[model samples]
Target: MQPHQIVSREEWIAARKTHLDREKEFTKARDRLSEERRALPWVKVGKAYLFDGPAGKATLADLFWGRSQLVVQHFMFAPDWTEGCKSCSFWADGFERMVPHLAARDTTLVAVSRAPLAKLDAFRARMGWTFDWYSSAANDFNHDYAVSFTPDEIKSGGKIYNFGTSGFGVEEAPGISVFYRDEEGNVFHTYSCFARGLDMMNAAYHYLDLTPLGRHEQGLPYPMDWLRLRDQYQPAPGKGACGGS
Candidate 1:
């Protein structure tokens, strides 16, 4: 817990400017990568997937709410589980505020989970999130999107996760999928990302990246090991006072 090398104002400015050049380079490179991602070919979504939301039954196109584009957060809340995944909750905490902004741009953002609508609604209320969350309990949306694995799939080694052949030993995984709807009501899957590819979508993670410690996940069994549901985080040690000897 020591401070970095101290420097005079002139020296600090010079060093910061040098780093700023590298940051700009990275920004440009990221812009190009985003362009490439948008250029990826899309696939037509033929399945008539349905979801149970607060407003009753909804289809994939209906989730868009008259918007041409949709962003689905594949939340990992299994029907058998009492609550949503902590990691998924961490990701969702950043979603509520973006709903209106996304709608303004002709895009809608919503969450899709396999848990029943009542469970999803109760948990959403507990989390105090206003984002539209829907249940895929009656549809193959979660399975088709590669978020929820079937019992047979798990028993035989769930290898379809993250688009890899490695056997994932879990019934649920987190992901995001994007879709587009044309004038004729045709829906298409434009993009989907799993695992670490979703890093950019979490604002807290990006904010952590700007600090000196940068997530501070070292020495842990895994990244996000320190995370908890927003309401579950314990008060910071002493609320900032040092411990007594």
Candidate 2:
């Protein structure tokens, strides 16, 4: 950890109060942005997306499970991969706990991936995650959402992700999409955010933001290169010893 300035109680309080004012302003700005996000126009979903699950095929509307709103985590697990992406798993770990809370607010949270339903189920069970997860292997949901890129698209250097703002060549990417179901059972695509826009949805990252090291990763190959699947992490050390890769 970098050394921080030592300060007297009076000096510390004065500094903290100054920072607090900025935090309040930031909080208000975030509130206004959220309101604007909610007010954005929606697009009617024309495709009848069918997702494969343990129970069988389920449409996008069926995924809502009677809720008026649905939140889909576009997880990055391709059909051939034996395991899900470590970073996507990190986000999923936090999302599983939020299922009940979101349901209480009439919102359904689920994860969708391009991997086969069996593969998804196996990986999910290995991670001990129970939040609803489905496979889009039988449909074009992933491509339609711009989270999965075709081999040709990658070969030609496609820039379809993030609304064509980026040229990520990976076979899959991570995103969050929101949909609203009206009384007539029409599902509308409300909003979708990709890349760092997902940072706010992760509780652990926010907690880390308050720490001195702040996710570390200074010289790492990538921001999440140090991450391991939950079961793959080394056991925590005793007392103050650092551990768990």
Candidate 3:
């Protein structure tokens, strides 16, 4: 490939406009897809699902928490696992501020994991997050949603299948499930999406795309590595490190 060169201000502006026009089409397409998804038929979830809450046991209907709608994010934290997945944790971090707005819209947003309540709480404390999280340790909810694997499936080494006839297998796939409650107290599943569908909530990627590096990693989920609770984030040591100090 030819060596990259910095362009002049006029050239940069023109290029930016061209990029923005393309991006506009993408945005419009996404909006249209979202509308179409919303129009899909609702699937009634009559089966009772269990969840461990802060106070005690809760059912799938209880997830609404008195709201008409509920959004559950399948966070990657198996019951036997020690900690949450790094990428899932990053997505969970954004829910702190979004909870209020979702509540205002008569929707409750919560993170659901396969980990036990105690372990989930511990990790949440370490992360300093206040978003509501619950355990689905005793149920097949995660497996049903293609977020977790069954013991037998794991033993067979064919657990990472997607939702299809050929057996949908995936490794701790991230997902968002939406539910709505009717006047008669029946809950219905409205929408569910996984993987890239959840990308908008990733603030890191959105910010990185504006930088020169621009998420350079080809196969990595996000550009930044997993951050620990106690880790102090310092900019990469470089020429600009002392410029603003």
Best of the two (2, 3) by lDDT: 2
Q: Highest TM-score among the candidates is held by which one?
A: 2
- The RMSD (Cα, Å) of candidate 3 is 3.7
Question: All candidates' TM-scores?
Answer: 0.92, 0.95, 0.84
The global C-alpha lDDT for each of the candidates, from Candidate 1 onward, is 0.90, 0.92, 0.80
Name the TM-score of candidate 2: 0.95
Q: Who is ahead in lDDT, 1 or 2?
A: 2
Candidate 2 regions off by >4 Å? 236-245
Weakest 10 consecutive residues of candidate 2 by summed lDDT = 236-245
The sequence of per-residue lDDT tens digits that candidate 3 reaches over residues 1-245 is: 23676999999999999999999999999899989988999989978888898869999998888999999998988767888887787777766788999999999999999889999999889888888899998888988877776656656666354453233344466788899998899999898876667788778778877787776775566444545333334656664445553
State the displacement of the C-alpha of residue 43, model 1, in Å, after optimal TM-score superposition. 0.7
lDDT of 1 by residue, 1-245 (tens): 33898999999999999999999999999999999999999999999988899899999989999989999999999999999999999899987799999999999999999999999999999999999999999988888888888778889864678886456678899999999999999999999999889888999999988998988998888877888888876666656323443
Candidate 3 residue pairs in clash (backbone atoms < 3 Å): 160-169, 160-170, 161-168, 161-169, 161-170, 162-168, 162-169
- Among residues 3 or more apart in sequence or in different chains, the pairs in candidate 1 whose N, CA or C atoms overlap within 3 Å are none
